[model samples]
Target chain A: MTAGVPVEPGTVRIAVDLLGGDGAPAVVVDGALRAFGADPDLHLLLVGPPEAADELLGVVHPADRERISVRPVQRGVAMTDDPRRLSRADTTVRAAVAAVVDRTADAVVSAGATGATVTAAVLGFGRWPDVRRPALIATMPALAGPVVLLDVGGSFEARPGTLARHAVLGAAYATVVHGVAHPRVGLLSVGTEAGKGDRARRAADPVLTLAPLPPGAHYVGLVEGYDITSGDRADVIVTDGFTGNILLKGIEGAYAMAGGPPASGGAPRAAALLGVAGTVVVCHGAARDDDLASGIALAAHLYRRGATAAISGLLADHARDGHLTGPGTAADGPGRTDHGADERTEETP
Target chain B: MTAGVPVEPGTVRIAVDLLGGDGAPAVVVDGALRAFGADPDLHLLLVGPPEAADELLGVVHPADRERISVRPVQRGVAMTDDPRRLSRADTTVRAAVAAVVDRTADAVVSAGATGATVTAAVLGFGRWPDVRRPALIATMPALAGPVVLLDVGGSFEARPGTLARHAVLGAAYATVVHGVAHPRVGLLSVGTEAGKGDRARRAADPVLTLAPLPPGAHYVGLVEGYDITSGDRADVIVTDGFTGNILLKGIEGAYAMAGGPPASGGAPRAAALLGVAGTVVVCHGAARDDDLASGIALAAHLYRRGATAAISGLLADHARDGHLTGPGTAADGPGRTDHGADERTEETP
Candidate 1:
């Protein structure tokens, strides 16, 4: 799916959390309208209060009325809300995820608290068999091409096993969604040298080097932060969510400070969720109308590309071949499988 | 020490590592010359092979030769060299540190491997009594005057105690060096909300909130990555070395991609070493001549302002008042004191 080209032929039903962002409802309505106007084949399942959904429906032409639907979730998770509240079915983000699980929508999109959305998605659509922790993968417009960075906020722990698994998820996403051939995956660290980072990076480096990647994808040792924008060292950069999330925002802020982004594009405000059974896209909490629109487009693009199933199928194929019994796989036992489960109680929304 | 203003009144002697960076003697020699020419009171003690030092001496006027001294250290640490080799006295970075220890130079500046320089500084100058882990602090020219970011590459672990201490160190540095009255100190996390970060950050938040800061400094809770560039949230941003190093470079890369940095200034390539008893500045390993010159100037500026001594004295005063008896202090016991000592064997230079 090429960026800047708004039109695509496939009809993608997206369940958008109308009360997700800091600007919520108003921006979501405006963004949904912009996205709806841009794409002729787009369908939105507005999951929020009826008043907010009606605001969007009232603006669109009568002929487009049939394409939009409302789930009417009165409650929306607050940015300061506890993530545990996502378990409630009435929350807009959880209701959005429910739309996907019930087959009412093709994908899910939200600008809500990341932990809440991740939790709702995991509860609504279970994780893939071989995968434990899911990752949020963002595509950066780099000098070379699109650079895929993962675990932006899906998982915060810097586990070596999780990083190794993210490498697989990033490579598969790059290849399947971005259409990159033989994507070079690199673990993000302080320096490109073998042991140039903290304890977590030092431990993850060798694991990533040895872990089997999807066909046409290879591990490129270690890479520094410059590789994220320059894209000279690797096509997919894997890092812990804590670092990746901060770096992503840091880049966005730098771009803002420098007047604007480069000609190619700027840091993405939206990211695709990987390792879940359904397609999911997350936008920044402070997303503007354009950012929210871009996120909706990204969700539609992922759904149309069949990225979730294709990437899962690739990992399952590798698992059947005995190549996926590594640290992050099911073979690591029940203890490791509790990746996002514990965070529901520990994390804030 | 104001940026862009090249000249200072006091004569500050800096020990330059001629064989440090990826470009080694060429850029170091060129940068040393640029720094020497810019500041009339700058005295450089060239610490490298006689041949490399003589290359700089050859071009200067005979009368100016008196200000330049040569230490004639033939050995230099390679980027891929073992960090433990810093224990050797002959390497350029170590010899440069020795110049400060023996009062031959007021400060040391190097573009050598960060871990090596950090280890060498710890061994040569010894960490401050109350500071178990030394931190590398870089001042970014933000929309506000300057934002001080700590642990850029000194310590990599994300221990809660370490972060709390670094907050104290950063607050002291900002107040003493940058002259920010009532500096707002912030713990770098994923979000501004109280509990919006990883396990380390979650644990570090309360500790920092309760940790007694230097006089005229106050804890401002958690801040996001955007604050580093915006400088709207906090004057001092504290983070682990792993995250800080990557974020610093990420901002640099974004600025490069955006054509150039904003009108304020670009991301800093040089960072000052805090917690060490002597003044030292570390340049990026891939530093260009201008960056190297900036690093040298930064070292001279630190020396002229007596930053190291003043910050340390402030912390010492706090320690005397029992405010420093927390997790990172000598009271934390010997286990915590071995911060940089163990990394000598584990890390690569």
Candidate 2:
């Protein structure tokens, strides 16, 4: 029966948590159907109750029905649940990550509570070597080009070493995934001048200036918040997750207030999870069907581009070159303690 | 000579810093001319070099020349100059503030470095009783009337007491100035949930919950950055200056990226100085001629409304009831110290 399935060379299987977003099951079912209908070679592994999977199968074209599969799981992480509960292995997001671990799917996509998703991914796929805290990178569709913003919600630490590592990750991701050559990386602050931000930013700026960037990327001096949307100064904007998350949402709100986004695009509803061993995408918790579909498409695209492996390889190369140091290293200097533990339970976008 | 000039009952006198902002003198001249031409009941007290004042004089219609007066001072504070240097009396921003102190001007407007303007304002106008830190409040013209965002650049500290104090200021400003009947004040965070932010926000959230708000104002719990532009959640959004300044500029940049702002309006270029004894508006340091003109107009409107005196009276009422507590009070709880001094030297918007 399996041999009869037509699996094309470009086929990319995605494990999606059905009970993820605020409009879960319904929106996820509709989103899965839309994603399946949009890409002929796409396959979905639905990780939720059988009823939700049936809803998608009921409406899909008869000819394309074979592309869908199901992994029944009744329990799902609640938005208010502690992230540590993901260890139970029965939650839908965890099941989805397990599919990726078992090689049944190429990647995982979930719009569930971000803390739960990040914890599940970390437990199932593991973190990259020397990466103490993972970073979530969002691409803003600026008019000039794509502006990559990092640590949107992965880790909220403001440590200089953490920011410096994320800068390297962001530069590599922009170059590897977005095809940005010699990406200009910047530290986001209140102003562009060198000592213009809070204690964390002021400390991180000099560390980033001295830290070795990925092969082609170079650190631009401090860049302001305007630079995030303008995309005039830096290709990759590195900031603490606390600031990045709020700023990303603020830009999204501004676009909504302006009737709609620009000709280029609006703030992205989907963000890529870096510093993890497998490809993963997390959508907004209040995501609509289209946003979930976009998340699925982003996961597939990243898997097809071998983005996870390529970025991990770049980090490894840097580590091997003795340039990469994890959090709390001497490179971070004094006053740079790990603030990630306390903020680990906060929800992401 | 001054008695010959027409002084209407509605006339507002504003001291304009002719050497403030990036495009100093030239853009300031154009801005002052634009402001003078637009408002028939406006009076200008130009503070800058003799040549720059003469430039504005050269362009004005001869019939309206009496409405403009010049205070010749050679030195203007450079963006790179330390804000502490504003103690020198000859600087343009200090001189502008001095005009307000001497009863020659009803308000002061400057596009100079925020730290310098804030320092000068503190020295000239003095802070309100129990107001340790001054806040810069910018009003975003949302679809639903207006949204007031505070601590744009006045103080960068994240102390719980400071945030609580700013919340009171914001609620009063929204009610008295924006005429918001009953303002819903919210603490800006990564998420709307109670425990969804970093350490500072987590500490500040509970403090705000119990802090005594002015009459006709209520705490709406926590709000995200999107609330600033959407105007869906709260009328007053409070955050530390570091976050507020960046978010405001980010919204402005988003508007620029969206071609233009909505019919309602865009991000405000001028922010009112709250917690000070006098009416003051600080324009963006990168202000263009139109932005500077808008700052002047905002100053005039605020002065005409007697917003500063009214808000101060409201605060006094609250304090008389024994509800207002300044920074470092027991109301702030433990771990809330004054982080204002360190960031005082950093340039504002």
Candidate 3:
């Protein structure tokens, strides 16, 4: 690595899973080069087959190549493969997670099968204390600023408790990462009115209002799809993974259909994985080179800012006061333990 | 109302809710006037408080006033009003539905509360035999052509049978209205691969595959949000009401954010309410003058083409045979009534 001037003392290292994504090695190679070229104090741990790493090594200059370390692994989790296969020992994704667990890298970045990355992260980096479901947070560049949308493609959750926890995670992220002052948080639904959605949204509405928010954040009631684009109503928009995932993809598709995104910005293809005890950014499965570079940049930014520790610390403090506590327990929702439809009996009637 | 030509033999009469939407009376009046101006032989039964219709009557030429009839209902259905109130005769929406049932109007158009419109339509026209849940179908301008998405905001149904019935309705509508050579129908889910979604989608997947389709349609397995905008994969995209409604709004919001829609067209705010015996178009609750006008135009087009009757006739023919003998029905599991999640217990595991 080129030892740069002492701007930030510690160099942040990111483990890039080269085998992930539809484009695989070619796009991944191009993205890694771009990310490395942009960040002077950044280092990359290439985790995949040696040949894939060599492909990147062949192109980059010898001076920058020192920053790149290769962790050789062969197998990859396919799009159609079982999500649990990320747990397999020789798989590149699992190896990449192992590198982070072993302190070889400060953060992880992948464009692999989302379920696979999520599983690997959950299994590798221990879940945050009292945080059951680790969420995938995507920040879209809106007219006003970056609008933080969470649970875009993590665990599928519908319980009021999970929603409440995700709201807290989102609020903390907005304040710590985006530096928003008194971030306004909103729950995503069809209509802005309190009772304008289906049964799950109806149950979650009052619960969100009643729950305590992180310092400098307040619940702004329900927000419609427009707020996600305008970023006028709320800084943080929270929803179930199922809805968020589809909404994110829908917006992306819309931008494509419209020829391009607005002059302000467009829907994001990369999302930061929160709730795990590490910094990770997951890119779209069909991401382009730039999207992967964005994912890499996000991972580096999170690592530099110590976002994981700060947000986790915020949650720990919030939990100690028993503020904004969910149903059953703090460790009872999407990330922490396995809960099915039966657990929602209290809110479902 | 500008009657430029003599009324045709099969002139379709549409009841226009003149006091609906945010910019009521003004926008609705303008929309009704525009729709009349556009369609030479169309007839309009204006349903609202007399003041709204009076505003329209003052502007129209004397000879064209005969083409416009007013039903002086005192109250319009407020957006915040309970949907159950739609059954009351005093409401304009209910009276509008009554016009259709009374054979005064061939169809109805409203930019009011979706729940109210659905409730009034179900009460007045009655759902088609065996149709427990009606769907809202919207045609999106896609790259390939029109991509028909259903259950935009009709009823929140997660049942497999409801989805299956929606498939039949969508296939029939695509063939009769859109006139695709061989419509390819897809079930909207998280992934194209089998077993790639939540419980509801998983349950609906096989049921949709096994269920009978209407003429000139083939099941193309699972589709994602992108398919709705791109239309490269399927002509008809199907999903639960909750998901479809949110996706439609999300796309609409994106187009608005991007300044405008693509050259082809933008997301539609107007959707056709299917499963009711009569033809009805529901615009967004926050619809502007142009949106209201577009809804009216869609209604007139549907009425002129006899699309409702043709689709209904196709379904009737299937009913007569006691089974849908369409393209994809004879390939898989047993066909059954009742589309709830309970039906999938036997098929899944």
Candidate 4:
């Protein structure tokens, strides 16, 4: 599907990858039950072995059993498995993503390894037209607002073109998913100075300045690593997947070192996969029960908000203008649409 | 100077960059005063304007005035100034570094821009035979113990050869500075799995495995960002300068978000500059007086422990064996000495 099927309000069906996490079946079942009890209108498509499905159905209220349906598949991808394993179609993460592409579920949540889930989502749902490489967005609860960090682990390479494109994706995600109407996006660098970063960041800074962002979003030069938690510098922070993943884990580790996290919350173990055609949330491979539950909740929330569809549509506007750097023949076509005027006509005007 | 002059016990003199931080001279004066008051045997060589030095001496007790001396330098490098400005002998940071190189001081501490300080130290102190690029090592107080993080902002690039050399440096620093025997060194990668990192990491991993470390130090394979705080996986974490700096700042920001750091301390605002011949410590550009004081204290600690000489002494042993990668004439000479086996003859043998 080029675009995700529009999610209906108050009835979000999420495909849960029962065998996705290190504590598979057990922790996944606990997370599913918790999410089911909290969100009355939520439904779950259990994709794993029949025994694992039976384990969850046993504890769930019989009346609520109607909300959950089992899709049995014994084969699942292990954390150490190669990404090519997703082609088998029987892996729990692949099957979970397939449910969304086939319209059997509104979104997918997996506590599996990020690489496996990202590969499955890309293979199953396909990438967005303007997104050559997908991005994973992780939000940290800063004092001012939530800091949206992108490309957490979608890909390792940090080409200048990819960093700029991810900036666009991150800006849209911040506005649509986090409700930041006029999001301030910044390129994550070692220092906030003009020429303060590795070669990729130095090259990406000028490109980000020229790249046309969606309506109500502006690029605010370079930001330091501290901005990720302070939220005083920018709302959306763009970085290479390698640096983003390391930074997230480092922040999480620091929180753990500092007795506990602040009253707001700890570092997020779940991240939303952007640039895919379907809504997907990936939890940490070693996810705890609450982390899985939070991942499920994040998926449901994104589905309910129609975030995937809205973000894709916003990017489509930029894609038509050739503002987003991607691999596509349509980018130079005469049939391309222009809605640049429509963007500024809103609040930003 | 290829080798630093050995420091005398109970008479370690430190050169303080008077015009170093965002709050120059004033905050530096406060820091120098604090450092002077705390250590009875410490001597200070103030390197800045004569006016700034006189202001400091105005407040000091008459009896202790003999311990403080002035090396007048009217010019100071600004954060935005070109790094080449360090070539000007008039700059305070360069003058401070010269003090250590010329045996006027045992160590140097600067709260200036990291790039400028690194440049000054390299120019004044010269580099060790096997170090192509200098390294900034910051030790974090993790739950288990002090976690040694290297290349905080030594350079921007991450070549395989450089990373392997940095592993050796980090391993040696942990052993000598932190008093940790049998230091388990780990390359900071996205995952602990063998093949999970950027191209540089993939290439460097194997080199690290084959790279012979000093006494009681061994490669522990790839480690994640969590290892930087938990200290469970590795005692010495090696990463590229860019990633290391960002991770350090991110952890510091996380601690701020979580209200305060644990009882031990927050992420260090000061770091020791390695690979140079003399002892040097660089504080954050935005460091407070207490942070500068801590930086001074760190410089004092390194001077007292004779860390720079010892680390270089150890690296020289590797240089003699041609185990280190660098462009140096001394590395190819037959006159290179042998002191590595001596390190282990005491206990590891």
Candidate 5:
């Protein structure tokens, strides 16, 4: 080792919600151990009941045990509870988010209800000024490379303004996280034509086309559902939360039906909550051991890559121009009050 | 041998629009040849340009030529044109529907635009008395069996009433087509819980539960995206065409990604247009030769099995009782008007 050489910094401390998934302490413990074992520099701030952390500690080698720490809290958010329940104080998901806010942990990872995790992240870390709604972005390892699909389950409604903002978020994510040079963004529609989707898409098209993107990103008009896996047309695909959630599950089911996923891996069971100040990744409530491990890896990846800070910096410039907010982007779009996947356990896949 | 005998009528004549696809007469002609060669009892009333039918005639066996006839008119409905274009005289799709109306053909099939085929079927044969917005149904092969998914691209708006009607249509189709004695119908939503989807789904859930279904059919509440392909929860899954179209394509892409489709089949490129009195099947505009042949086969199967008449009869009884129209179901929901996947393409498969 050379004395003057700059040391590599790969230490990533992820706050893991021990009471997050369907199997709760059991699945979370297994996943954390797996993630910790895979990366030598990885550290975990186990956030849940002391008993849950003890279970994770029971398995780690004495030498590696130093990398794991505990932030004990008893309460866990039930899948049926409203996402706003995270504000009730000391809930595992909320505590996990708080760990990141207080710098006790570098990032947050959870398999608790998506809505609860999103709410907690927004409340604890705050949202970016230019992005009204925080989006859940999942990267699919497409044939062309990694394709970033956003709003997997953050919010249900798709306003012209929200969609325009998502374009910026996705474009920046593709550049900072996936490292695509000039990210091509696209709005998910039924067809690739100019006028081929529903009302929300039709209205959002012109708005997304008008809005300016960050860095070297540009809009690629409309792309179809096929483009998500193929990656022939767009590197970043923007869609309302409802369609995105369904598409994610549908792709996962197809992979399962086809016996296994492609070599690059299947649709992600975890998605990163973009626009929040701190890095946060939400896993499916029914996520398996590997899904939880992958979620932890994703959170660690975000922290190591400075994705949240960098994407926020990208959007800040757009906000300065006053062109960030989309036209007709108010608190909510017309007619649609608040709609999305019910805040509950996803049992299908 | 008996001195006198009566031959059972096994002939099922189909009117096919040769100019319906992106590949047009070439793919259609090849498909017609394939179909004619496969079924000895099948008859064709080709309804495109005389030259196109002549192309088909060029390949038919001399003895089998008696089973083919031409209803030549040289117009095709361009996919980009509005669905209302079917009203223009001499359009191939319109002529095909007219052939079914006049009893010259037992059914009609087109690889043309979906909206145009639905419109032509409605105008030429009239919508069934019980149904409002005619739905398009595609049968996807699942591990359990066949799952009937409706409104693949029929219309965009998801009115509570319209959804209730589609449930009835889907239920009857499942029983008659797949022969499931008790078809379990599920409203396609984000979750399986009672309140699991957006406003449209929330409003439709209660209405579907309260609505009386056909014989041996029952509602299974809300089902997630996985149920469409897995068929573990329900036999019939209902959703707005915008969502259905996107999900269908997304599933197709996933299959393509996972090497190929399962042994059963890939996503159906052709879907049956339900709620119309006459039998009609619409294929993708970019349909290959096999897809075009399948469209013709689907149309013939519906006619031979009396699926259109039987399903209509099943709905008629409910229509007589005034249970077919859902509560708060009008033309459009409340605010939205006349917006859907432009009645042009059923393409993008």
Candidate 6:
């Protein structure tokens, strides 16, 4: 849209939910200020009550005031609010997504209720052409390199078709976002043996083996939980959100128990929401100031790379020819059939 | 019946699966010898090929050879063998369970496929009257005593009745095995907040809250992944096998990534097979020498305390008073139906 201006190369705009997460505006404000000071070109669209926004505006220097903006929402989707309450427009997360949809910001970030953010994004930016369930992908810094874990807390479907689709999304994301060459993908299971794992994992195994992957990604059969940290067996680990979310949190807890994370970095506190039309990052619900800053930086990084549009374009191109389903499997029901299809996308190039 | 003698008080007999795990026979023999030497009164029933059992026999002194018995099963199950092959009698794990059933061995331990060991125990020792899917329970050594995790890799069904049954088993096991004065049971979810998990979890939560726990156990609603490692929220955390399996392995992987395990201990590699009428323990499929030894020791510990029989009695007494569900409920379809018929017990106390 900016004609090769690279969207927000030097200037990155991140819309943050002021009243999101367990700590809310207090911690959110602290994190926004920290992120603002760390990145000279970083701008924030604080989305919450005016009082909360004023707290951050009062702290930042007048010189950096130009980099800060506010889109004050009257209220936030309370943590205790019913999932149906997400339809309300006055919610902070909904307003934050509006900033992105309106092109007032480059990306959106929140540590609020995952369901609300997902609902808002799906409603605001609209699902990608074929993505039924928008996935929350987290990249953990493993022993070898970055390991891309998808569906951290998005869809919870265990259908073989859903898993196979995630494998494609994961592979493409690794290549486009992480710059990995020929990412080896593995299905998380109890054992490495072919027939191991629950019903869904077993059914998905054969499908993935036969289902051709995007360029620079190959199926490496079954892998175990160790692969998430070791990064020895595969670069991309695909799992349903239920398992991924539990695994992610378990790893975080383990790091806490073991004094601290490894020198190679601990479990990521932030995750990028993939499959949505906009770039969104989500930190833990109990995020600290440092965690929030990391989320901000991740949003900045995703914005700088134009990851949303680029990945969307790649998917679009791939889906235009309907090649996303690979060779000869064209009869597969609606691209997002079996899974929850929250981030439905087309089988395009 | 152990001759009504104390069995030397610490005199424990464990059936070690010599042909189990990735590095079997050699590693199993080495691990058994280490466990034997570590515990002076420990006895072993080494099950596998004659040559594998002979490997251990050649090392120990002739006077102590009586502590070591051999059950020669020539055929060994490969890692890739079909899960149905678990019913085969020639496998070492089956032989180990047979030794326990025949009263030659006190308990069975194997680092073989979980399906194989589970099936062997079910067929040999019979199922607990009230349980359908025998839950695999593992105790993690946490800073705060021990955290008991159930259905780590047993049945993967997510039905509410299964979860409730597993809760009873977990709580009873916590009291009988871990000796916790009063175990606090919890449902594992993404957050401690109510209604925070997938449909299966949400459906199981209320059922667990109202389900009749053992005499000294109480349900503490839901706990997060952090609770699993910190042991701050509950003593016994229960979930479907699929999630529990991944979470357990993920913790193990995280600890490995953190250089080593914490000061207390690491993720448990051995899981005590509960729900079966006899004491059985399953080690990691990729177990090492030390891990295999730990599994053997765990089985011996269970047998020594009469853990299986005691836990079974607890469930049986509770079921007789119109507390537990029927066989149909215990093995009901997915979705965890909270409202179910209170029928007669399938397995008698």
Per lDDT, the best of the predicted structures is 2
- Indicate the DockQ of the complex predicted as candidate 4: 0.34
Question: What's the lDDT for all of these models?
Answer: 0.82, 0.84, 0.77, 0.78, 0.79, 0.78
Model 6: residue B149 alpha-carbon error in angstroms: 0.6
Docking class of 2: medium
Order of candidates by DockQ, top first?
2, 1, 5, 6, 3, 4
Model 5 C-alpha lDDT per residue in residues B1-349, reported as the tens digit of each score? 0001112247899999999978999999998887777778889999988998998888888999999999988889886776445468679988998888889998988887776777788889887875667888988888888899988888776777788889999999999877899999999877776766666777789988988898899999988788887889999999888788888888888999999877666788888889888888888777888788777777777777888989888888877777655334552355332233123424333
lDDT (C-alpha) at residue B69 in model 6: 85
Off by over 4 Å in 1: A1-6, A326-349, B1-5, B326-349
The reply for model 3, stretches above 4 Å from the true place, is A1-10, A324-327, A330-349, B1-10, B321-349
The interface RMSD values of the models, given in order, are 4.7, 2.6, 8.5, 14.0, 4.0, 7.7
Instruction: Give the poorly placed runs of model 4, Cα more than 4 Å off.
Output: A1-9, A328-349, B1-9, B84-86, B325-349
Reference-based lDDT, residue A95, model 1: 87
Q: Across residues B84-133, which tens digit of lDDT does each residue of candidate 4 receive?
A: 45467778988998888788988999888777787778788888876777
Task: State the TM-score for model 6.
Answer: 0.92
Please tell me which model should have the higher DockQ, number 1 or number 2. 2
Across A1-349, the per-residue lDDT of candidate 1 in tens digits comes to 1245346799999999999989998998998898999899999999999999888888889999999999988888887876557567779988899888889999998988888888888889988775677888888999789899987888875566778888988988998888998999999988888987765677678878888999999999989888899899999999877788889989989999999999888889888888889998888888889888899999888888888888888888877887777444532323221112233322211
Tens digits of per-residue lDDT for model 6, A111-220:
88888888888889887765666788888888798898877887776556667777878888888877897999999876776766765676678888987677668999
Q: Which residue runs does candidate 5 get wrong by more than 4 Å? A: A1-9, A83-86, A326-349, B1-9, B82-86, B325-349
Every candidate's DockQ is: 0.52, 0.56, 0.37, 0.34, 0.43, 0.41
Query: Cα lDDT for residue A182, model 3?
Result: 92
Q: How many residue-pair clashes does candidate 5 contain?
A: 0
Clashing pairs in 5: none
Q: Which ten residues in a row have the lowest lDDT in candidate 3 chain B?
A: B340-349
Greater TM-score among 3 and 5 belongs to: 5
Candidate 5 residue lDDT tens string, A1-349: 0011122259989999898878898998998888888888899999999998998898889999999999989998876765446456778889988998889899999988776787788789887776667888888888888899987878766777777888889999999887898999999988776777777777788878887888699999999888989899999999877778888888888888888777766888888888888998888878888888888888877788887888888778767777565434552355432233132222221
The model with the greatest TM-score is 2
Candidate 4, residues A1-349, lDDT tens digits: the string is 0011123359989999999878998999998887788778889999999999999899988998999999988987775666455456778888898888889999999887777787788889998986777888888878788888987887765655667778889999989987899999999887787767765666678878877899999999999889999999999999877788889999888899888887767778888899899999888877888787788888888888889999999999877876765564232233211111001000000
